[model samples]
Target: MILALSFIESPIAVIVILGSILVFALYYFNKKQVILRKLSKTRRKAVASLKTNEFVKVHGKALHVVAPLVAPLSKRKCVFYTIKLEKKVSSGKSSYWKTIVDEEKMQDFFLEQNGSYVIVRPVPSPKNYKSYLVKDEKVSSGVFNDPTPEFKELLKTYNIDSEGFFGFNKTLRYEEGIIEVGEKITVAGIAKWKTLNEPIPEYAYSKIVELISDEKEKLIITDHPKALKDSRHSI
Candidate 1:
């Protein structure tokens, strides 16, 4: 009698097994191309740009160069970043180089020029640290000009300081610009940028050495959140 009962329950067992298999299959499919799904409005622009421009493949924290690669770093890559100030940041901060020299060096990274803002280098940093200057493209200027009602509503929903937090404070700025996975794009519409002589490889650890921008409060941020925190505290 027990054996017969076990056989009768065997069908139910098979159905349960099949359900588990189906769930596992769904999970795998989603995991493979998860990035394409996760990106939001930025994806639309990246995808559309790919039609004319070239984009590198970016997924799983991996970046592979596209065709006509300019500068490829075999070990590491460098990228431009932006950071904002959570509080007032000081300019006269000592770096490791100054300590080794046994003297306090008050280096002004943001130069006080005549009607111009210049970015000086930080001490203990490589003299030729890879960085790029992004001159505003003609179209990029208008990209964020007319704020949509939805964008405004989101601002209200978050209850954030629209002026301070938004436009480009030294904080919450460009942490990094990994190629949007969906954007298999090229540099067709974009203009030439002043960057390092070589490209940084995907595996390399990069540090943002300096912040260069016409905007006073704006700065470049590195991918490492810890470094940004340290920069804020140190200065």
Candidate 2:
């Protein structure tokens, strides 16, 4: 208690701690700005005009070449989905939402534009590329309210109990985002042409092209063109 009071009483110590936090916040903000600038500066291109090894951005309706995934919380069919679980944590006189679980999944999908289809591979390579998704669905449960059976099951899978030690419901929030089939979305990546071994529906071309992230560039598959503005769910 003496040490805690001394640390709080010392102006220099408090200033140094606050300054460190400010510096960290600024650094993080700048890093995200750099990524946003890169995305904003890239010019959007037509699917037919994309060249192999070229970096391009394309916007079109999402088309699933394969079976779509069911979003965990909403059960909606989508090419990509991200779920975040946060619990409220209280300290002294302040409370903050602390993230307990963050999960995201994606599959290959097609981007159709003007009768031309380009495959989009959202899986990041070993080069540390990233995908930014904007979650549009959210749900919350707390002491006065209880989660549904499905929500409790999900929490069980993560080994998190829905109730606290006294059997009261814990304050929790869930956010889910998905890129549904036929949803208009934007993608940016390095384009490459690949020869198809078999034919596929809606596309007659024997040789198909795909957008993927490479060592030099990261693939961006987003439901919103302005996803950088709301990137909290980025994965």
**What digit string (tens of lDDT, one per residue) describes model 2 on residues 1-235?**
9998887789887898999999988876764444566667776777877889888777888888789998887788999888999999999999999999988888888888888888887754443345556678877889998998878877888999999999999999999888988898878788899999888776788987788776678887666556424322222
Tell me the TM-score of each prediction against the true structure. 0.20, 0.78
lDDT for predicted candidate 2 compared with the true structure: 0.80
> How accurate locally, in lDDT, is each candidate?
0.26, 0.80
Q: Lowest-scoring 10 consecutive residues by lDDT in candidate 1?
A: 97-106
Residues 1-235 of candidate 1: C-alpha lDDT, one tens digit per residue:
9999999999999999999999987875653232222221112222111222211211112122332111111112222221111222335683221111111111223212122221233232423222222211111111234433443333354353334435642211111132221212111111112334443433122321122322222122112222211211111
**Model 2, stretches more than 4 Å misplaced?**
1-35, 124-128, 148-150, 227-235
lDDT of 1: 0.26
Candidate 1: regions farther than 4 A off: 31-235
